[model samples]
Target: MESLVVPVLILLAVVAGVTVAYRAARKRKTGRPASQAEPAKAPQELARAAADRLSEDEHRRVYALIAQGQAMAAIKLYYEITGEGLRASRDAVGALAAHPQPFRRQEPAQAVEEDDDEPQRFPYRYRAIASKGDVTREVSSNMLNDEIYGRIRTLARSGDTEAAANALTRHSDISLTQAREFIALLDD
Candidate 1:
């Protein structure tokens, strides 16, 4: 037993060293100790508002991780990016992946500080899908619903595609080009 003491002591010391290094690295990366708890975040449920919160690059990154089937990693990334609660991050990632959102440039009137010009914010998000051959696109937004989408579709079928595309862009986060592409699929 006396002869075995040195090797066991060395092994314990190595393990303790590794543990300390790992924790220090984690603290440096996250700006908090590994054992520290995260504070509560705003918005319990992720609506279209989640898409509104993430920047274009961050939105793409989260979706890419989800597409690669790394849900846990995506959740962790979204949690870090948005500083949202773990549960909210998970839900946001799931929602964002299921219905991909294109980045919409924020209009001056849409700022949160203004009360009067703020467009209506919805609790639920709506999805409208259009496909031509193997190419498919989806527009998901809180500003759209079944009745509104039907009207847009009617505008497309009536040979008023430009108007329809404009309406789609108004309702969703997609750009004019993307809205036109989506409208092309609906033109039939």
Candidate 2:
């Protein structure tokens, strides 16, 4: 038994080394990652966006499917209604399940305009929030990207609150008074 100890120790060390090398090589051969990635939208914001893509009846059915623990059915329903790819529909369903968002009427124009350059559809959504004291306001829309939001912020910071409010209302579904209230917090 004593004579076999050294050989057994060497065998174990060799096996460990081979296993480590195999894992390292496997990690290097993974599928290629996305070439470009947009900043992630908030999960609740995404849930709201997903819900907004559905019409009233579709929304009810999708939520019902989700409540019944039928994830695939919910995803399928969302995909059929929104015409999104399988992966996006799955992700949207997951987000919706994790965070329940209120149903706001989605404009038809806002739903299909994500692709501007080559007419590809994108599921990205944006949400802007402002709060002062006990008052808070939120704006969610597909039309409000980071650049547009930055411009609105710049306009507000430059003392052009009215123009900022106008721009906010143009990109979001909020009313002018609500936009003004939202803009006021950003000026600080």
Candidate 3:
């Protein structure tokens, strides 16, 4: 019992000493001298450049997408193509689709001219809600662009003319007349 008591006390003393030393070392490493501290920049000044580069609407959109936890790769690709970052673009898209009152509404459609002179076309938002039997599918503009073109060509080659025409009309931003003309050309 005496031998065990001494060994236990010695072990406790050693542990306490090591703990004190470790804590003291950590404090010494972390505690910077007053002269060594770096000066802080103003938050407004720090954010100014990023703010200037992106509009308020863009910022809101990006932050909202980020909040929604979108994949970084998809966001990066979107940002690369569009000037807006992934988060912002996602937020903007969501706002456009879901919000009752949008912060920025798209401009009115311009008159189509016969001549070569054409105004910039604003990105269109398309949502197709289709129900077949019990299954309902909601297709968005982005999904249509990504998958419809190839599907349309395949369907057309397979002699599924109706399906191809429907797919082309659903995918394209052009009028039904224009889509029909294009699909007719596919036959030729």
Candidate 4:
């Protein structure tokens, strides 16, 4: 009886030691804080968070595309990659067509200045995927508006010029005069 009791005690001690060692090994393998052990964010949620950082114009363009009834799948893919929605992307197009304000030439004497130097400003350009691949090209406000004008001209230059012109007049916000001007420019 004495020998059996002694062996039983030894076995219990070994089991406890083994359990402790196993737990330590697991902790080392994970190497994370206890609070961080909860489930991680999904890829889609992370993508949306990243997309939220896009510029206002970019956001407007994305929203505009959404308004235009583009596929959600395509919009989602674009948002994930470029951090822009359809509406924001389209608004960016309108902004590109507007004149830009000049950079401030001088600092105000009365204003308190900080230690940090002002960062250099550059011209804003639209980046679009063209046939030549991804191109970052500068465009004037006139050029930007010209894109809309050119589209109208292409439609009018085809088989039913009058019908195309009428369609442009009806569907577009631009006046009929503007459409005619664009068509004439295309002819030239």
The runs of at least 3 residues in candidate 2 whose Cα sits more than 4 Å from the true structure, single-residue gaps closed, are: 1-36, 107-188
Which whole-number lDDT from 0 to 100 does residue 80 have in model 2?
90
Highest lDDT among the candidates is held by which one?
2
Give the alpha carbon lDDT tens digit for every residue of 1-188 in model 1.
99999999999999999999998998999898877857534433344677788777877887789889999999999899889899888878888777677776556575455222243557899999999899998999998878778988999999999998888887778999999999999856
Q: lDDT for model 2, please.
A: 0.83
lDDT of candidate 4?
0.46
Cand. 3 Cα-lDDT: 0.53
Candidate 3 residue-wise lDDT, 35-150, digit = tens: 45556434444334333444557656544655666535435533664677666644434443343232344455996552212223227654544344554544445425434455
User: What is the C-alpha local distance difference test score of candidate 1?
Assistant: 0.82
- Indicate the TM-score of model 4: 0.26
* Candidates in descending TM-score order: 2, 1, 3, 4
- Residue 60, model 3: Cα distance from true site in angstroms: 47
Cα TM-score per model: 0.37, 0.39, 0.28, 0.26
Model 4, backbone clash pairs (residues 3+ apart or across chains), number: 20
Clashes of each: 0, 0, 3, 20
Please, what are the lDDT tens digits per residue for candidate 2 over residues 32-85? 323333567888888988988887888889999999999999999899999999
Q: Arrange candidates by lDDT, descending.
A: 2, 1, 3, 4
